[model samples]
Target: MRLHEYQAKSVFADAGIPTPDATLASSVDEVVEAAEDIGYPVAVKAQVHVGGRGKAGGIKLAESRDEAEQVADEILGMDLKGYHVDRVLVEEAVDFVNELYVGVTMDRGEGKPVAMVSTKGGVDIESVAEETPDAIAREHIDPAFGMHPYQARKVVYDAGVPRELARDVASVLQTMYQLWDDRDASEVEINPLMVTDDDEIIAADAVMNIDDDALFRQQELAEMEEETFEDDLERKASEYGFDYVRLSGNVGIIGNGAGLVMTTLDLVDYYGGEPANFLDIGGGAKAERVANALDMVFSDENVDAVVFNIFGGITRGDEVAKGINSALEQFDEIPKPVVVRLAGTNAEEGREILNDELVTVEETLEDAVQRTVEYSEEEAQ
Candidate 1:
């Protein structure tokens, strides 16, 4: 969903946007090699997901091979905002007279894509906004008609872009908009869009985040995603077709829908219990699916107790109960205490069918959560 700088720039170049010539390197030797190839005065920047890389000393300037090697050695393997930097981009340092910021992202309040331009660049846009809100100009673009050229120019001019560079900036903004639309991107940005005295524009920094749900259609873009997942359970969750997120809490939660799962998590927190994970079985989940969900939750060592909150609509409570029973049968001994709260269609029958000896069935969500939290707290002691 989020891209490292080098990866984002690759997307930028693919869209015909001009960027500083750069090379990706995974080692100090490779960094020096890239610097040599790009010719001196290159910028060595660590590739990480979070912002403030510059502030974290993740970025450095190297005018020679020795400096490049030194910079590379210092950056590679360094942690930037909790992300380990394994790669660095060695880019040709642009001789620029001006810097600007250009970005396109959804303004949820307006329910439209917002194209933004600011004369203040190479700095945190948020700080600029807080300090001088008027320095940034925004234009709301309709998804139906897309970004018009006039609107782009107006935004650029309002950002106080000099007359000579207004057209070029506008062109870049349109290209960015086109890229956002064409790639199913939730956001695209070019910070410090450097403008040279030679009347040339280049993207000095790139940031793009594609919509996770849209990855299905954007095959090529999706392929560009980092091949490695930091979380093994998350990788397994994807394979198992479960809407899941791992958490640090001891009480594992399973529900039929996203909203229900979220509420269950909130309740776990409110009851003074930490939620170990978020697992949504989705509507109409069968016995087998429920069994699979149970297996997944039990696999987590962090989970001390599990709670099943089912408000059946399309999801039949009987099926869910059957799944819980079948899944518990697979274990020679139950891995953790499990609490179930069944409501709506066939809930009473589902409750009756459940193995009372194996799981605790509660009448209300609060009772189920409270009982599960107690189990987890007992485990902690």
Candidate 2:
């Protein structure tokens, strides 16, 4: 549910936040046209979902239309963190005296939306936090009360910005908060909220991530989703009604609950193995669902081994076992080794059913995780 920079900037502009004039281009001709329209010294940025675009040669400064076209052609097909850049944001360059950071995000631990601000901006906020924690200021805003003007004013003032820009910054923060709260956003960030030489403030870069659960309320945003670069395994899982998130590990996890899925992934990591995905089959682990989940995991070439930690409280373990057996019969071959730990109701019968298979069955979660990691590592060597 992450919006591209241009999409986020459009939202900010609609909310009355001052942002730079920019145009999105998908081709060299479009980039040249956009740069010519915006004039010389424009910034060409790749439109990708992942970060570190600057470090990955995805961001470049073009002093002329020719340069813009050259950079755009080079960046449009380049991959940034596995996501191919299909477009570039051509924005007019501005002369700024200082840069600052402002963002509002959900703090699950605090159960509130936290407003974060810092004088140091245009860089990874996490690195700033780890190196200079004191430079960043954070305030938790109660969801019930929302962000007040006085609270935002205090943040701007505390950040050591000039008095002339405080009110403007406060206004931007208020508008951003409105967009965040009204649209059910997971994060809204304006990096390098620049203070221009003319004493004007503008958001140089914007990012917004909408809550996937709340997409039901945002038809327009949902329609804006572009799935051109989604992982193949994830798309397949979605087609089969399972919630899947692909990760970069060898051990594939399948479980009944989200909590269990996450715990299984952590265990894999703890046991010195990476999780291939977080695949949750929901509470009802019917034969179809289990088979679909296993099919999705086995399709992944990176998966060296599979781990099924099914604690069937509501879902019967025997049903899950049957699904696995059915999937093995359906597919010509299961690509990787599998480790199963079926506990809770009907566990003994499920264990007995899988005993005849080549899969490893462990008594404990730790044992299952250790065995999967060992098997994957051995296969790798």
Provide the TM-score for each candidate, comma-separated.
Answer: 0.66, 0.81
Residues 1-381 of candidate 2: C-alpha lDDT, one tens digit per residue: 888888889889988888888998889999999899988899999887766788889999899767887898889888665556788899988789999999999889998898888989899998999999988888789778899889999887877767988888888888888889999999999998999988898999899999999999998788777632454665687688888887756788998899998998888888889887898898868877888888888887778889889997998988888888877777565578888899997888888887446678998999999999998998777
The candidate scoring highest on TM-score is: 2
Whole-model lDDT values for every prediction? 0.90, 0.85
Q: Which stretches of candidate 1 lie over 4 Å from their true place?
A: 226-381
Residue 328 error for model 2, in Å? 6.4
lDDT of 1 by residue, 101-192 (tens): 99999999999999999999999998998999999999999999999999999999999999999998999999999999998899999999
The alpha-carbon lDDT assigned to residue 193 of candidate 2 equals: 93
Best by lDDT: 1
